[model samples]
Structure formats: structure tokens, C-alpha cells
Target: MTPREYCKIFAAEARAIPDFGAVPEIIPLYLIYRPANTVPYATIEEDLVGPFERYCVKERDGSLAVQSSSEIAQKCCAFQHWLYQWTNGNILVTDMEGVGWRITNVRIATKLKGYQGLKESCFPALLDQFAAAHRCNRYCEILGLKSLESLQQPAKPKGSKSPSLGRKAPSAQSSPQLQKKGLASPQGTRKGAVSPKASRKSTEAGEAQLAPKHKEEGSC
Candidate 1:
């Protein structure tokens, strides 16, 4: 059965204290409404306390009858089944459920070593954890449980400097050094924009000056 159908069946048919007594036909275990943009823990204490207190195993002998640890253990079993069915073993329960399970596992270990009545100490917290897990699931559904790594801005590489945003920083290599033009620096000449004619004339003049002087016969 689908989880929702299972939940509906549980709400209607499941006995809270394992005995026939007046109980909520529908336990609103799942939160449906809350303040805008806010996620809060589920209100499950009332749901647990009512049925647990009302339908606890009654002693036939005339004495003070209290809730049994066995009943709590039964409730825990139901909780585990629901959790497993709901999650379908795909996503691991973390946060409250995870923490409570850790404690319960330790307690079980201690119980195996001769400890008893651990469920009396463990059940209430487990109920709270179950409620928290429900709340978390609801929150994830509403807000979406996606990896933020794709949405997040990528981190800069290590040791890389950030580009300044306030003002443009001057670059050392941007402005090239001016190339010299002829013997004189022309007032209008740009660094790399030297006139080709002036360059050719300058080369010819330099060659003439460097040539050997020839002595010739006296002219008439």
C-alpha cells in the first residue's frame, strides 16, 4: 500500500495502547499548517499522552496501575514499521530520529547485559524523535531537499586574488613603453605610431654618416 493510504489506515484502525478504548480516529501526525515561511516541530505529545494514559494495561488487583514499558515498546515497533514503510529505505532518517535510535541501540545493548525497563526511559524521547522526523520530512517536501552545491556560488581557487570591484586597478603591463622615433621626439607622435617616412629618412642619414669619406681629383 502507498504510504498515505497506510497512514490513513493506521490513523483509523491502529490501537494506541493495544487495547480497545476511545482514541483519535485520525491522529494529525503530519503537520498541515504553520506560520508563513516557518517550519516547526510536530505536536505529537498530546497524541501519545492521551491514548497511552487512557488505555494503559489495568491491573485486575486493586492497586495503582501505571503505563507498562511493554506498551511503549509496542508503540516503538509501530513507529519503526511506519518509518521504514514511509522512507522505503531510500533516505536514512537523520536529526532527531537518528539520535534517538543511537540511544535506543545503546540501551538495547545494556539490556542484553541484564538491564531492564529501558523502554520506560526511552519511549517518550523516541516519540519526540518520531515527531521531529515527521516535521523534517514535511519541511524538506515544502522547501525542497536538493543539494545547495549547484545553487551556491562556486568557491575561488586557493591563493587566487579576488578582482577589485570598487575601482579599476592599474595594470603594470597594460601601458607599453614608447618606442623612440628618429633623433627627435615628435610632439604629436604616439609611442608605437611612428611615421614610416621619418623612420626611412633616419636610417638613410645614419648610413651616410657611417660611410668612409673618399678623396677625389680636384674639380675644374
Candidate 2:
């Protein structure tokens, strides 16, 4: 519901401006579920055919872990950056996944913690380090966002380690001098549009080896 609402908000924002720059249009999958239903998923998402690529565009702590070489992917990352600034450092969407341009299974990290299913992702610490962890990608500038680092960051937790590049005010296209904020900058770029899918290990053969059971009295 959050993703759907956000998508609507962004779409409306884009429509309001006479000349909004090109941006990635994210379409979130809606969930239709009922308790005690036999179906695993009520609204099963269409599984991807061929090689399905999954990439982590942003980190929980607001850093660009994968500054993807693909322009589209970069735009996706910038959306996350824009959201933080749009909300005045309130909510940030991360843990992006899915194939091609449609991102699903995302995680939302915000300052106000402990909401239903978002407890792990919404911890305030993630947003606390935003001004430190975030690196301004080009699309962020295209959206008319100034260096996000210029936005005053909340004080980090005591004894937390600072980023390797340290803290610095953001520039549209330049890296600012580092200040003391606990987090790391980009480790490196994950180039290429599609990532190679890793194989998932099958369940233990031992489970299949369990003794066959007789039917319980009057069952079914």
C-alpha cells in the first residue's frame, strides 16, 4: 500500500510540472491475500522468463552500494535519494529488487521506527546517517535536488563508526570534503544492466528419506 501510494504521489508530482525530466516509472505489484487460503500467494506475480537480474540499487543506510552503469538503474537509485529529500529526511525506500525497470520487494527505511512489517527496515539509524551515507547520482541533480549531503544530518548514535570517505556536503556533480559521519561510501560500481542469477540450493535429500506415514484415524 505504501509503494502504491508513493507511486501515485510521484506520478502526481511529475504531472504537476509542465516539464518534468525523464525519470524511471516504477510500477509496484499489488498483493491480494486471504488468511487460511490454500494458495501460497493470492496475486502471484508473473515470474520472469529467461535470465532474471536482481540488483541492490541502494543500501539500508542510504548509500549507493551499486551505482549501476545502466542509466535506467542509476535513475532508480536517484528516486530513492529524491524520496528522502522530498520527505525532509522522513522516509527512504531501499532494498530494491525485480527485473528490468519494474522494481519490487523493496524495503522502506524511515526515522520513525517499529511499524507492523517494517520494523527492521524502518529503524531511525538508517535515516540518521543519510547525509553521510548518500552519494549524489546524476539523476538526483536532474530532479533539481541539491547535494543531499547539504541537508543537515541527524546526529549519529554514539560510538558509531564514520564512513570511510567521512561526511561532506553534497555537490551536484562533485564530491565534497569528508566530515565525521559513521558509514562508508560506494564500495565499487556493479556494472552491467542485468546481474547473473545465482542458483538456489535444493532442500535436503534427508527430508525425502523420512519414513512413509500411515493415515491417522478418520483424517480427511
Best by TM-score: 2
Using Cα atoms with residue i matched to residue i, what is each candidate's TM-score against the true structure? 0.19, 0.52
- For candidate 1, the lDDT comes to 0.34
Clashing residue pair totals per candidate (backbone < 3 A): 0, 6
Residue by residue across 52-106, what tens digits does model 1's lDDT show? Answer: 2321121345221223244333333343334433433221111111111111111
What are the Cα lDDT values of the candidates?
0.34, 0.60
Per-residue lDDT of candidate 2, residues 38-113 (tens digit)? 8746654556454444454455454546545676566666666777777777787766666676666767777755
Candidate 2, which segments miss by more than 4 Å at Cα? 11-22, 33-43, 55-64, 114-121, 153-220
TM-score of model 1 relative to the true fold? 0.19
In candidate 1, position 174 carries an lDDT of: 53
Candidate 1 residue pairs that clash: none
